[model samples]
Each structure stands twice: as structure tokens, then as C-alpha cells.
Target: MIAAAALIAAAPAVLALDGTPGQGAALTGSVPPGTTLQLDGQPVAVAADGRFLIAFDRDAGPAATLLATLPDGQRIVRPLSVAPRAWRIERLPTLPRISQPSAEFRRRRAPELAQIEAARDMATDAQGWRQRFVWPVRGRISGLFGSQRIYAGEPGAYHSGVDVARPTGTPVAAPADGVVILAAAAPFTLEGNLLMIDHGMGLNSAFLHLSRIDVKPGDQVRQGQVVGAIGATGRATGPHLHWGMKWHDARIDPLLLAGPMTP
Candidate 1:
């Protein structure tokens, strides 16, 4: 992994790229204010403070591109390298046809999908992502990001978050400072009692399978503040907490941000 302070000389502009370049990496970087940043020919949002986040998809290519255009019209292009990762796949014979959602399930999921997209689309310059992230709950890890299940020779959807095995009613805290954007107590079809928080600049965290939610939309929460309790709601088979994170619409690894968990 490259250091965050690595400087790249691009003739007219010296761009400093923070964070590693890999799958599920939410890299932060800075350019001159008013500079337009582009990733893979797509326009990327830059905060007023000159901070921008670059997100790598789980199956991103081995190489990527970054284009920066200064206020004076000078254009800088830098190619990026992305590292690949192996995923965990579980084979199940008794698994239902999860890959195909029923009409009723799809109808009920439309609004939920919209809400999740809305929460992730939020962008602010508060730098909440700059703070270190801590584990929301401590327990044995049962699932991981990008892991998938195979049923009857068909691959199902990848696991969207990391699952921590814990007893019911275990307190779940905010991994970092953020404003609550979603708090649904009733168990959904899949996510169960889902809660989402926006940590400024399109970075967000989601807690799933919660038994109870204490925070509501628009509520400010500090790091380590209790927001919910663990449970086996939704499709979970046992009491656990699913912690998912994202930068904009790109799904990132929460374990990467939280670092190693202590026993």
C-alpha cells in the first residue's frame, strides 16, 4: 500500500494522493480549489475545501485513471493501480432462490433502495471521514465484504457488509461522527432494522439487523455513541450486527476504516 502523503509530479500540478489504491479503497486527495476531478471520464465531486474522495469498486480493473483540470485550464492526468482480492464463497444446497426477487419483494424494496441511495448521495465537507473509525460492536466475525454464496451452481449476491456475531441487545455505537439519515426500527425484508448515517462528503455508514434504534433522522451523533442494539432481525440466522459503509454509491470495506479489532 502506498503512503497517503505520496506526491506525484504532474508538470503543472503536484497532486497528493491519500490512501491506498485497491479494491474498496475510499481514497482522499486534494487539488487546487475549483479544479475539476474526473475518474474514468466521470466527473467527481470536490468539496469547497479542495478535498475529494476516490472510490474503487469491488471488481475494479487492475488499472484506473484520474484526470484533474486546474482553474487556469491546465489538465493533469494520472493513472492509478488497483490491487485485486479473493472473495469467500459459501455453497448451500438448501438456499432459496435469492438471486431472483419476487414481485412483492421488489415492490417493497423499491422505496428502501431509494432511501439508501438518497442517504449515500449526501456530500458535506465536515471531514468526518478523516477521524479514525472504531468497531461499533466487538464479537466474532461471521461474514465479510465481497463474500458471496453459491446455491445450486448459481452465484448469489455478494455480502454487502461485515457481520459481527453478538448476543441480542448488545449496544452498537457510531464508528465515527455523523448525522443520522435513516433509522427504521421495523425489520425490513432483508436489512431488518436498518440505520444509516451520513458522515459528510458522500461517506456514510450503515448498521443492519438491529433489534432497536435510538437515533432518528437529522440527529447528530458522536463517535462511540450508542445508536442501536444487535439482533437477528431480517434474514440473519443468529444475533449479529452488519456494518456496511460507502463513499457516494461505491461500497467500501468497513473493516478497512476500522482497522484491526482487539480481542
Candidate 2:
């Protein structure tokens, strides 16, 4: 639990400039017509309905602000109050040692990286995916976004996306309308059979460990559209879908971006 003094100290009196969160709570709000919103110095899109939202990184420390600019140039700042969360930390003693990839693996991974980079460089033509997002797949959540991980008994990177555990060949759908930026078959060291979509304005989603890709690059897809099938392709112990979302270079939590997942 967060200390009462911390919450009180973090909370602001009025909308003055940028608003910050308490500790772990996310910062979210709306803006006026024709105006933009920024949270933690990242630009957020304001929908036609005047709704806008931004999320803090799960590891985000205390002391951040949310800023909204009115159409008439009026600025509103509000401090955020975030509640602390108890995290589960595990240290494995017999983790497998990761060796350098073979030359063949390196040769196969290069093109895949190039393709993904090209997709990330796509231009934002319109605000098509700013609307509410639909679930790409329905299943039990096997992994959560922002959870610290120690893979194969070694200290590994933090989990950057949500993982859905489903049977192999389960259909994977688009979470929102977007252009298919990457569709290719490659050997990924971690994420296997990956596909990425661009949702405009530096927002993107990636589907990993897929069995089949139904969409192609440059194709326009709608929310709930079946884009691929799930599988255990790359480095995996079982069949699962690894869904990741990003804002420009920042790896925002996909679950935060889309809210809670449905069963």
C-alpha cells in the first residue's frame, strides 16, 4: 500500500500544468477540442470525441505530470496519485546459459530486423486506430506487461508485453484498425513468426509466435479481423501469443493501452 502522505503530497489542487501520478498508478484524462494532450512528455492523440489517454511506464517512479492544452492555448496541469503495487520477484538458481547464436541464426535474424524496422518507419497518414481497441485473442493471460523476468535461470529483460496462453492454431485478430507493416517468416531468437501492424502516430502492435499470418504488408485491417493463428514458434515452451504495443520508441504497456483484458 502506498503511504497516505505520499498520495497527499503527489495530488494536485487544480488543473494547472502537467499532472503526475503517485507511484504506480497511471495518468489519464481528456483534452479540449482541437487541442493535444501530453503525459510524461509524450504526445497523445485527442480523439474527435475529446477523449485522450496516456499511461506511465510500469517501472515509472513517483513524480510525473499530465498536461492538456486547450484550443485557445489555455494549459491545464494536474498532479497524479498512483498506488504502489507489490511485485513478485523470483531468482532462479539453475537458469540455462545462453550462448552466442550460431552464424546461421544470425543470418536469419538480420532480414527480420530489417523488415520490422521498415514497418516502424511507416508514415502516419490518418488517425484511424485511435478508437477503442478490441482484443486480438481471448484466453487466459499467461504473462503480464511490465513484469520483471528471469529467463532460463538468467537475469533477463523485463516483460514488455502481455502473453496470452491458448492452444496452438487459435485465431489471432487485430486489436484495432491499422495498416499491416510487417508480415514475414523469420527465425527470431525470442519472438517467433512475428507480425507487426502500424496504428498511426507512432503507435504499433506486434504479434509473436504465430503459426500462420493471414494478412500482408500494406494491407488495411479492421479491429477483430483475423490476422494470424497462434503457435509456439520461436523460443517457447508451449503455444502462446505474445502481444506487444509501442509508442514511438517507448514500450508502453499494451494492457494499459487497451485496458483490462476479457476472458
Candidate 3:
């Protein structure tokens, strides 16, 4: 199995890869032109120039396989090792509450989820995925990604994003260049004033609990552009910006892509 940033060449085909290799990690690499790529037997999108991006889910297995079929039909196989991370798991004294979904929640949630899924399914040509990501806001980290609470032996949903504790009306910037996909006209019941941006290559960002959305759908946004304001508009107790990122179906850790928070 190959580790991080390893390159292997087979005859006329060349496969070069580099990035963090672990659960919730996003890896970028390139292969020979006209090469088809796959991760664990799943077809991966390859740009015209042979550049590609792949990410491991938060609960991805320790090992994965990458297959590249060159233009000449030569197959290059790569065994990848995905390292595991220790998430912050808290244990509760009582068992999990088994509650049925409310009728209102079930009604409003279906459309909201449909919109999000449609946005993610869009294959945009934005090149933001190649750029270094920046923090949408700089402040005290109120919540961490991949943190979960366990009730008895049952595990609850882990935190999907990193939260920045900021005051209401605090302007939040776009982490990278992208086209706005979903700028909710009205607040969502749970996400509030939500804004989603597609950075291309199956990588996207979602800003939750926003007070205002400055951009509209299909608008091109650059890195550091003001896109929204922080607020406690949904099920939040306080005003903060929840910045979540996903690569296709994989929920990636934004901190891993954006690095340490800066002023």
C-alpha cells in the first residue's frame, strides 16, 4: 500500500499523488491524460488535464484501492492506507431517546434536503478546489468537527463542521472561489439562512445559521469575498458560523483544508 505523496509509474502510464492520507482527508493528484480513475471501485471525476480529487469519509475504512486505466489500456493499481483519527466522543448516562419525527419536520425537511442534494450533484467548472482554502471567519472555536456525544452505548451524530464564535452581523467570507448554488431565500428550520457554494470537483461548502446572504444562486464568488453574516437564526443557542465542507458524499474536516485559524 502506498503512503502519502507517493508516485508510481507503470510502463507508459504515470500516476502521481500527494496530500494527507487519512479519514476525512482530501487528496489531489494527477494521472496521464485520458486516464480513468477510480477509488475503491467508485468512478472519480478527472479534469481535462488529468487532475483529480478524492476524499475519504469520516468513517472510511483503514484501506482503500485506486485504479487508473491509461489511454493505452494499461492498468495502474494503487493500494492506499487511510489512517484513522480519534474523534472527541462523550458518553452520557442515559440511553438514547427514541422519538418519532414530527409531521412538520418531515414536511419541511424533504424539500430542504432535495435542494442540497441537487446543488451537490452539479458538476461546475470552478477551479477553487486547486487553491489553498482560507477560514471564513477568525474567532474562538466554539465547536470542533467529528465530535459526538454517546447516550449509553448508542452514538449520536457527530459535529459536521467547525464553528467560529462570532457576534451577530459579523461578515463571513468565502473560503475559496466558487459558484453559489443554494442561497436560501427564507431561513431553513435547522440551518437558518443557509448558503452553499460549489468549489468544483465535487467539493463544496455550506455556511449555516447565517443572518444575511449577499450573493444569489449562480453568482461567482472569490476567495475572501463577503457572502453572509453570522447569526443564531436556526436551532443554535448563540450566534456563530458553522462552516461545513463535503467532497461528494464524504464529509471532510474543514480544519484540515483551511489549516490553523489566522487573524
Candidate whose TM-score is highest? 3
TM-score of 3: 0.93
For each candidate in turn, the TM-score is 0.88, 0.75, 0.93
Where does candidate 2 stray beyond 4 Å? 1-28, 45-51, 82-84, 94-97, 103-111, 125-129, 150-154, 185-187, 257-263
- Can you tell me which runs of candidate 3 are displaced by over 4 Å? 1-13, 95-99
Each candidate: what lDDT?
0.83, 0.70, 0.90
Clash numbers, per candidate: 1, 13, 0
Residue-level lDDT tens digits of model 3 in 1-263: 43343434443237777686898889888898799998988899898999989998899999988888888876777878899999998888586745767999989999999988998898788999998999999999999999999887887889999999999999999999999999999998889999999999999999999989999999999999999999999779999999999999999999999999877
Query: How well is each residue in 1-263 modelled by candidate 2, as lDDT tens digits?
Result: 22333322212332322334432222334455686666666677666766544555556666655666667765665555554545555666676646778999898778777777788988654354556676788889998776765656676677777899999999999888888888875647667888998887667899998988999888988888899999999888899999988766666656655668765
RMSD, each candidate, Å?
4.8, 6.1, 3.8
Ten residues in a row with the worst lDDT in model 2?
8-17
On a 0 to 100 scale, what is the lDDT of residue 191 in model 2?
Answer: 79
Model 1 over residues 77-133: C-alpha lDDT tens digits?
788889888888788877765556789998989988888777666654445776878
Candidate 2 or 1, higher lDDT? 1
Better of 1 and 3 by lDDT: 3
37 Cα displacement, candidate 3 (Å): 0.4
